[model samples]
Target: MKRMRGLLVLTILCFLISSVTSLQAWEILQQSGFSQALGDIFFIDEQKGWATGYQGVIIHTQDGGKTWSQQKVELPCDSELYNIYFADDKHGWVTGSYVMGDGFILNTSNGGETWKIFKTKDMEMPYSISFIDNKKGWVCGFGNGTILHTEDGGKTWDVLYKPEKNYLWRQIFFENAQKGWVIGCESPQKGKFFDTIMATKDGGKTWQVKYYKPVADEDWWYPWSSIWFVNEQEGWATICKKEATLLYTKDGGETWTKHQFNLGSWLYSVKFINQKEGFISGNLADSGKGALFHTKDGGISWELTAEFSKSLRKIHFLNSQEGWVTRSNGYFYHTINGGKDWECQLEPKTHLHDICFVDRNNGWAFGKYERGGGLILHSEDGGRNWDKQRLELPSGDWQMGIHFMDSQHGWTGVSILGPNSTGAFLQTKDGSKNWSITEIEYLPQDIHFSDAQNGLMIAEIEGGPLVMSFVQTNDGGESWQVRNKVARDKELGGRRIPSRIQCLNAQQWWVMSSWCLSYTSNNGKNWTQKKVPDTSGFYFLDDQIGWFGSNRLYHTKNGCQDYKEQELPMPIEWISDIYFKDSQEGWCLGNRYYVGDSLERCIIFHTTNGGETWEVDLKSPQHLHRFGYASGRLWAVGDNSVVYGIATQAVSALGKQYITLGKVKTVLFQNYPNPFNPETWIPYQIAQDSDVTITIHNIKGETIRTLQPGRQRAGAYILKKQAVYWDGKDDKGEEVASGVYFYTLRTSDFSTSRKMVIFK
Candidate 1:
């Protein structure tokens, strides 16, 4: 189960990063106009604004918040994004942290169209970012008490202060480049806790404690959750102690006035358009009530503007009249009347997670609609507008895994609900305009297609933990059966899911969990295990050679049977994912610890001459995730819900012809594990849409089984450590004997033959 957590975290990181990755100047594509939960909202002007949330989510609206378009951010999609700040509609920055002890402060100069990452030096997750102008900003968070200052529009940042104690700085507001107020909390001992507000005059080079307040009655837990400052002299902070408390500061933090709320309310977000007006919202978790407070007279007193049952977490205002508050229920309340009245907006029916542009005008985004059916949003006008295309899922499911073989062929792995629920595998052949779904017993975390007939899928088995079933389909989704049950330990527990699966063709494969790697030479029919401390990312050139990433990169020969470790140019905590175009060229992405804080920094390295030498590709440590080789491009997906691709030929000339083919041709490769151990993989590809078929024949020419008989475009291999092999079984699921056999691939215009020997 711990192995499952690897991909589980990857999936979450994928989603978390999805929302923000696309923000590189946002182009939002929602599901029936609904996206996932929104975390923070910011307005650049009365008409231009941005909102961010789960999955690296950032939405931009140019039309006074009436319609929002999602943007594609080009950062690793694994960070927990929190706040949005735009110096202008063209220049903006967003801040967040990663689960892996790292944080992000991304900047955009061209209306969110492109971004440059100003990575935090310390591993502390930045919670709040404030830019006084286009060139000066401040960011602060907990973990060694980080408070960062930037002078050149985030081109570089200077650590003003990182406290010795492990205090969590939540929010930082800079009235000017030099005058700033930072708010956070700390715990010195078990029961002793206090909240603090600080002031910095030397551009964060020096910080002084301005005010400290203790939560009375031994609670020691009065921490401010949100902070806002209209100017240096006027600021407000919301508290989450025993009850929701609103704290106001005037005269440049010389004094503060506390206004207590109902004992059950926990006010979170505080936003003020000006010194005279502001609003706050929070959830009364104790009573299942949602509360909103409004103050027109600069926080001297407050009025209950609205109430609901859901807990509110964040609030934003575009002027005092045009404001929105996000809640725990994945919905938001809007007020055009200065909080005198409010209107609620439900969650969108379709919430997209990923978007890929084949070209400027052709692209596809994925998400789920309200009914829980996976959907594709296709754009033909350079992402200016999108049209939703609903998928016909097998059991009315939503997408958990999605991949496109091309603009035409794609797959979506979906999860079904209810007692009669089974997993769903969805396919799109018409460029995402339509879909066909198949019901399966497993829920795939990742899917791959070596070709149409032979492929693999790694999935979490239904019903239990650490109990994953591996399956293969020789007939391409017609039927699936267990190839192996990877029960690492019967006594093991938790959510350890498979993080990565690398196949060096069909004969050998590698599956990496969080802490271990399983290798198979017989197409996943048998396996060998090596326990690794942080085996999160890996890549294999063949059965005999591979690299596993942890604090350091390790190399294994003789098919991972044994390995030796190598010291990288710098230390890494764990690799998120790894990729290789060939044996000689590859890329490694992983995290390294920030100097003193447990917070982490992401690192990227590329090797051109196998593992003999390496060089850093990234300027410095920044959060990055899974990578791939597609269309002569090295593609990387990260925090920005954005997919970044670099020309493959530029970095590695060998990758110019990465896929070995003289020209465009359709050929069937020989079955993997050809000598066979009861099962082997047969892979074939098609250049165009065609009726494809695969048939197995005995030594005497008698038909054993027809693996495939259908029209095909392209297919997915097991993105994990599984594959579709014959398994020496007949059409009726009967086991066959040992012998040499032939497999024929037949299409409307092409035919090929391969031989395999199956031993039973």
Candidate 2:
């Protein structure tokens, strides 16, 4: 009888695992949204252009920058694409680097419908690409001032020059097949560096230094950023120094003159439509505001034609009347009338830090601009369209905490600059259309309001020992009173500042930090400290039911009298936020840090058994900060303007299948020992007898193998012995290359897919 009970328990555990892996994946509601910082842009004409930037993103436009579409590159999606060049309408090239210190070049011959990738092992980080024609081009970057030449349309490349160690080539331009120029900077010793412009006359067989800037103090050095030539004799270059400097050459490459602008700007790119009309793009040093300067008298006198919230990276012009400028914070502008008017091509000029939704159709996102100011964005139709809210704020002010009781009652904490920069709270009673500022003596880190007349704030008081105080307001934030203060533990020798706060009502409050957890039941008249396990996040459904998350999850049901530890399937480094709709359903955002790699990939974990077990619902490259639930959907917002939403009903439906409602249906589990070297196992389960098959495909969606496992009986095939196996080979018995691959399971009426990685 004991053995029979053991078998039943094992069967139930297998069913739980199977059902947990079958949950619906989260979908991105809004991303990119022109929020990727663009590095370079190129236009073959006024109608067709391409821009490359962060995250290996390549966007193309066919309607004169009015609309854009993403293009796939045959490399890691996280690689950094820097420079793009098109020799004509049909052929083009892009250069970028991976975070793991490897440079790559992408070429397209059919107008970017597809791309072919070539790895440059010798060039650690290629920054610039210049092609005089389709067949001959040169690339320069930071492999000890490396210059590479490609004579056969980038199929192969030959090293042309590697001047010295600690040299970084920034930009390259070629006027013809034999005459080319490379601008870069080099550090001869430890403390100082200088800039140089080198000219190659024999298609990169040899080079001569045409101009060299002497090394200045270690505190200051002018580095060349970009160079452009309208004709053989008229050319221009930009130097990114404390003050913007322009280098001009009228007599070919023999003689050059310098022009300086005392606007406290750092110029990046220079372009000239004719000898007399030119433009320079950069940003102000103090304010980080993107600025575009136009020169109408051959680089003699300049006027500020445009400015943006972020710095400008590159500027391109087909003519004086038609040009494009790319900002450093994922924005681009187009002008059709010689810089007199410009139209921005992207939306959301801020990096969202937190988001809240009172209902399914109404929400608000809080963030700060790249140039240092707070921003409030409101959406009326479930974040499909957002409009910026106008608020009169001090310069250099940013929001740190926000809470909204409903659509009409909201408050935000603003951190400003000046003497006594203690920050202030902006309270709104009529849906943020108007706000009243209430100055406070402490900086608010997090705030929660139970009603319009009662709220609690976790604030930081500046003085000594890093004090964190809980303040309360009973009259709608018109005034605040300190309730309790927690100071740093001098004996522990670690800063203990409150990171998150929750207010259940006027009498119940909870506050947590990395090293401590505390709660107050009667408006902070008394407090009790609960033992925590290096807490990273905390969530409470009520005073009795609460959870604390770190590498592991801890749950309490009796107001922290005792805690139960829940085992997660995989190891997590940290949990950023937690949200629970009820006692049985919850979600937590975590990050998994790999050994020897600096990148921390974010993951969303879902639980339906009241933290008894958890399953990964989503994986994202961007960091997610908070989670919200409204109208049967779960929402998350984080870095890079990412907003993701998933239907909670779908999750609940999947949860009910194996836990309560019925038997487990077809379910596909993620492969074990993911990022395998020689082999991996694919686990799955089936409810009834059916024909089962598994197909493997590469990242490009080309099928590599189709495994016919024949008919399988109803049961959980989740163990290693029962799972389907792949030997890391294609159907033709050839070992597959190391990269990302997808495996799909099809059984009768059900089909699903999951991703895996292979590293050799």
Winner by lDDT: 2
Lowest summed lDDT across 10 adjacent residues in model 1 is found at 5-14
* Residue-pair clash count for candidate 2: 0
Worst 10 residues of 2 by lDDT: 8-17
Error of 2 at 391 (Å): 4.1
Q: How accurate is candidate 1 locally (lDDT)?
A: 0.63
> Clash number for every model?
67, 0
lDDT per residue for candidate 1 within 1-760, as digits (tens), equals 1111111101111111122232222122222443345777777666787777764667787876666788887654445578788887788888875543456788888888776776786745677888878998888875567777778888888887877665657787887777888777764423444678788777788778877876564333335477778887888887675556777777777777876555346677788878778777776546757787777887777777777756777777777678777767456667787776777543344444444555544666655554344555565544445565555443343325455655687665665545654676766677765566666767665565555655667676777536555666666555666787665443212223344556567667777766677777787778777776566578887767788865468887776667887655544445667777777777787654232212224545778877677765652223445564544445444432333445545573222222221322565654666445566776554555787778888868899898764676532222112223566789889887655577887878888776665433
